[model samples]
Target: MGKPFTVSRETIVLAPPEAVRGLLDDFHAWRAWSPWEDLDPDMERTYSGPDSGVGARYAWDGNKRAGRGTMELTGVQPHRVDVAVAFEKPFPSRSRVEFVLTPQEGETHVEWFMRGELGLVQQAFALVKPMDELMGPDLERGLANLKAQAETEAGSVA
Candidate 1:
């Protein structure tokens, strides 16, 4: 095992914190903003446990880039949602994902954070592209897409 990787990304969205939190609370809502959703057009997805909140779970098996993994929401807060992620195929690993929301005046500040130990395969890949370099773009893209979707959802409600 190599040094663990920690990647955190923050984005200001033109929506309420609760609204942004809602987006993270539901796995189904992720299809609208999750960066990996498009990685495999034929990805098989399964939703189990609660519909949303702490117990919500999502699993997917997809193409090479998509791989296979399962994520379960383990904690929930008015402004934070924590997820436990585990990969079974392509690589077997685990990670802790946290989404924090903060309301500013009228807009919401959103931060997506992930931390995990590097598996042997990941350690090798990290040599080619550091974790931040590899996952940062995806996180940024996901946040950007989330911002657009949250703002759009906010607009529709108004």
Candidate 2:
């Protein structure tokens, strides 16, 4: 056991909340924007439960870099999505991830948040490379990719 921690990143996507939510609500659509999607080109993935929204599940196992993890969509609303994530390899940890979308003008403000308790191993690792240092870039990149994809799709539909 270790201390609790939170890491968050936000970006403005030039699209409506619904558009951004579409990409987030479906695990399959994550391939278009998820930062870790390319970590291991041959990563094995499985999807179960509903196609999207609450109850949807996505599991992945890959090379050392990709590790192994599972994500379940625990809750979904018009402007927010909550996911339960568990990593079993490379580390063993569980986190609550949230995506909050707020409409501003015609665009959407997207905030990605992750909060969890670090394991003893992770706490030690944090001393060398903090959680923010490790996850901030990935969060930023994912949000940037999400913004680009959402804007492109929104523009095409306009």
Candidate 3:
């Protein structure tokens, strides 16, 4: 087996840690800001466990780009969330998702990281094309959306 690989992207949002943390807490709320949601608007989705906490799971089945996957909240901290996403279609692999929030000059710096085990198929695909290059843009878009949403909400509240 090859070493585990990771892809990470982050952005600093102009909001407080608590507000940004709330956005990360609810998987359903992700529709408002996640770039993946835009890829397959008709994807089948299901939620189980708590609305926002450890043990919560969000599963989806969609077209090729969206793929089929399940993401479960596996860990949590005061301003962090750790999720594991298992892809079942288009390819199969398990990836870890992490959200970290740090206070900076009254705003929050949010960092999102994803690391995982690449299956044989995905590794093969990566041989021809790097997944990080293909997926980094989407990650950036997601972070941008998150930043916008958090900042907008903070502005409204203040």
Best by TM-score: 2
Model 2, span 1-158: residue lDDT tens = 56999999999888999999999999999999999999999999999999999999999999999999999999999999999999999888999999999999998999999999998889989999999999999999999999999999999334
lDDT of candidate 1 over 1-158, digit per residue (tens): 55788999999999999889889999999999999999999999999999999899999999999999999999999989999999998889899999989999989889999999997878888999999998899999999999999999989335
What does candidate 3 score on TM?
0.93
TM-score per candidate, chains pooled: 0.95, 0.97, 0.93
Off by over 4 Å in 2: 156-158
Q: What global local distance difference test value does model 2 have?
A: 0.95
Scored by Cα lDDT, where does model 1 land?
A: 0.93
lDDT for residue 145 in candidate 3, whole number 0-100: 90
How far residue 54's Cα lies from its native spot in candidate 2, in Å, is: 0.4
- By summed lDDT, which 10 consecutive residues of candidate 1 come out lowest? 149-158
Count of backbone clashes for each model? Answer: 0, 0, 0
Model 1, residue 46: C-alpha shift (Å): 0.6
For lDDT, the strongest prediction is 2
Residue 79, model 2: lDDT of 97
